[model samples]
Each structure stands twice: as C-alpha cells, then as structure tokens.
Target: MSPVNPVNPANPANPGNRVGPTVHTTPKVPVASSAPGVARPRIALSTVALECPDAHELAAFYVRLLGWEVEREDTDWVKLRAPVREDGGGGTGIAFQSDDTYVPPVWPGVPGAQQMMAHLDFEVADLAAAAAYAVASGAALATHQAADDTRVLFDPAGHPFCLWAAAGAGDGADTGRG
Candidate 1:
C-alpha cells in the first residue's frame, strides 16, 4: 500500500480513481410554485452558507446589519435567522462555517486570485444612508462600485455586497435586476 497524489490520481498505488467536477446530463428546470393544482415543491432554499475564519464573528456582523437573531451554532458553524415577519412567517437564514483555511476573496477580481462565488444584496430606501449605515456596522465601502444607484460594501470576511436603491430613489435606473 502507498499514498497517491491527488493531482495525479492515476498511479501505480491507486488506479481507476478520478477527481474533478462531475457533469450533469439532465436539463435543469425551475421549481413551480405551490399553485392550486401543482404539487408542492420538494426543495426549498433555507439558507445561504458562508465560509469564514470565524463563524461567530461573521454571523455577528450580519446580525447587526440584517437584524437577524442567532438561531443555531456550534464550534465550527453559526446560523442566523431573519426576524419573523409581521405575518408570523419565518424567514430564510444565513449560515456561517468556520474554516481554518479560509482566505478572504478579492473583489473587482485580479488576474489569478480567488474571486467571490456570490454576494448578498440589500434593498435600501436611500443608497447613501445605507452605505453609511453599513460602514458604521463594521463594513468597509468597496473602492470599485459597479453602478451609480448601487453602493458596494465589503464585510469583515472580504465578501462584497450591494446596497441598492430602487428606480425612483434618485438614480432613475431600474434596480429591479440583481
């Protein structure tokens, strides 16, 4: 028995093992809403998971910005839930997982650096006010902004998010699209 190099999965020590992305043959379709005759959708998105060096710290940052309460947490993970709406319905949550190898991603991406896979968006009544609030809440304004109506801010983990104002919020542009 001998160790195998993952970069070279095929070796004398190990054979017939492949390591790479898997391809899906079937076409993906959107899930239909629970209409009168439509069957209930089997899948529902509960949370967006984030990886950071400190789950608790990242979660705390979101808690201040979104007014979400900590729902569940352990040594390596923390979950925060949005405040229950007036209608008494629950809200989607964000989960953070602490990874020892976590590296802050670069925004306005560089040639070969790690780029953020995704980012969060918050709709605000006033773009300038929103940016100020986020800055006061431990978030830094990003130097590279993509649009006039949308201000970009970076969280402690270096994830870039947008504070977007609607069409009539002074920019006169449609902020409906993400």
Candidate 2:
C-alpha cells in the first residue's frame, strides 16, 4: 500500500487500500444559554450528596462533628440539618447515600483505593481542641503541615475533610498559606 495523503486520508495505515479521503465535520447544534432570562428552570443549589458504603455511619459521623441533626433517614439516603447560626447564615445541608461498591479515597501517591476528591473546611474557636476532638471522634489525622493552618482529617468512612480556625478572629493562628 502507498502512503496516505499527508493532509487527509481515508486510512493512514492502509492508504489506497481503503475508500476515498475521509472528511471530518462538526455537527451543527444549537447552543443553549446557561444564564436565566425568565423561562429557564427555577434551578437553585440545594444540597450535596456523598456516596458512602454505609450511609448511616457516615451520617452519624457528620452529625457528631457539625452538631447537625438528622433531617431525614432511609436505607438509601440520609439528610442532615443545615447548620444555622443565630444570625441566620450558616453551612449548607449535607446528604449521604449508600453505595454498595463504594471505595474510600486514598491520598495522592498512596497505594490502594483512594477517594476521588474531598476538602471541607470548618471554622472553629479552638483549633487544637477541635482537632483533638475530631481525632477522638473516629477521624484520622491525614496530615498536619505547620505552614498551612489547616489540618486534613479523614472521616470514619475515609472521606477527607479539614478544620480551619477563622483567621484573625480566633485564638488559632493562621498557619495556612496566606
């Protein structure tokens, strides 16, 4: 077989053995606007769901850490009450759903199963106390870099999250990157 056309060829590997030059074309389709004008669906960010091997266990862990109450519970889904302050603004609600084949994430460069992505920061009054409490409550200390004011923690189910003391507002100093 001869060499196919340098620019375009029906089959580069089997030139002349195949059909004519293959033409590449883009399909014509209408692009929809993501912005809302008025007719778009009244969509709003509501909740985030995390898949866990055991929804009950994970939900309990969050409730203990955040002091959030269980809003709803079922075999497959569990929703926790959103953390609200006296001022009204606060953290969002979290949900956990059972995933039969769920495998916890592993730290980057660590061998074995690993979590895909996880990083949640909680502002606390006492960073050391809170970190200690979390460690006592079943969360494992993933890492503690002196340069970063945040400490990485893994929930009982192995989901990774963090605890960060509010900057300049609490006794905890900003050890994280400025």
Candidate 3:
C-alpha cells in the first residue's frame, strides 16, 4: 500500500497542498518598557553579616586579621572594609551585628550539632605569622591538625575561623588527595 495525502491528490510533491493560503499567528504578550518606572533591586557588591555577642569585639578581631579598616561603626552594628591587595583579587567585607545573650556554639561533642553553622577559611602566605596575629588580636586556637598542620581558631565571640598555609610554596605537592 502507498501513502496518500487526503488533502491534495493532484500533486505528489505537495503532500498537504489543499490550502490556497497559510496563516501564521503570533501570540499576544504584554510588553513593559525598561524605563525609569521599571523596578530593579539595589544589589550590593558583597555582604557578609555575622551575629555575635559583641559586635565591636568581633569586628576588631576581623579587622586585625584581614588588615581591614572600619567603614562603619555604631553601638549595634559594625562594618569593616576588606582592603584590596596589589593583585587583582580583593578581600572580603565583614559586618557584625550585636546579639544579646548569645551563647557560643560547641562543635563535635555538642548534642544534635556536629559542626559550626559557618566558618571563615583563610589562606595565608605565612601560617605562623597569621596565627600569631590572630592570637594577639584576641583569637584563640581551638583545634590543630598535626598531619596537615592546619589550625582552627575562634574569635572572642566563639566564631570559628581557620588558617592554612597556601600551596605551591614548598608546602607540599599537589597530591590530588584531600
């Protein structure tokens, strides 16, 4: 059996050639102009806000660690500006908000909580110097890894942060291993 077009039997090439004219219709859509009236979100370049028992104390620790200067300060809020290095890459800005009656979180042995909610990880050219600076800036070394030699430190408000030696400077080979 051969297939045949029921619409047109005269032209074999035109399978559906019965139509004298074809119509193409476009769906209607509401268009809005991208003008001054259009609403747009005011986005920030970068923001990292933290809750601490004392905003001033926490802000001071970060300022010393990252060499950041205070951009804004008040009784309840403090913001630090992360200075840009000679390289293109920039540092992070930290904001601290006061939290009254805040209890420090205990990791590992704490019931129902095995880890911290968030932690700041830093790569330093001189790990020893960084650790010393952190200590001088009111940070306590909480945990240390003998195998990898990385250390986890906490600020006065018990916010966990880490200091690790940067790679590619006689630290170790890029051993594809964690």
Q: Score every model by TM-score.
A: 0.71, 0.69, 0.64
Best by lDDT: 1
Root mean square deviation (Cα) for candidate 3: 20.5
**Model 3 lDDT tens row, 1-178:** 2356555443343344311112235424545544578776675567588888889988877877777899899999999987777897766688999989676766322446543566677766666777788999888977533224355778888877777666553545231213
Q: Count the backbone clashes (under 3 Å) in each candidate.
A: 0, 8, 0
lDDT score at residue 125, model 3, on the 0-100 scale: 66
Per lDDT, what order, best first?
Answer: 1, 2, 3
For 28-136, candidate 2 gives per-residue lDDT tens digits of 4556666557567777666688888898998988888878899899988999978678998866788999999888876432435563454565766677888899988
What do the candidate models score in CA lDDT, each in turn?
Answer: 0.76, 0.69, 0.67
Worst ten-residue run, lDDT, model 1? 14-23
Candidate 3: 10-residue stretch with minimal lDDT: 18-27
Residue 161 lDDT, candidate 3, scale 0-100: 71
Q: What's the CA error at residue 41 for candidate 1, in Å?
A: 5.9
Question: Per-residue alpha-carbon lDDT of model 1 for 1-178, expressed as tens digits?
Answer: 3456453344433232211112345535555567778687588789999999999999999998888889999999999987787999977789999999988878766658986677887778777877888999999998777666778789998887888886577645455532
lDDT of the structure predicted as candidate 2: 0.69
* Runs off by more than 4 Å, candidate 2: 1-40, 109-115, 144-147, 169-172, 175-177
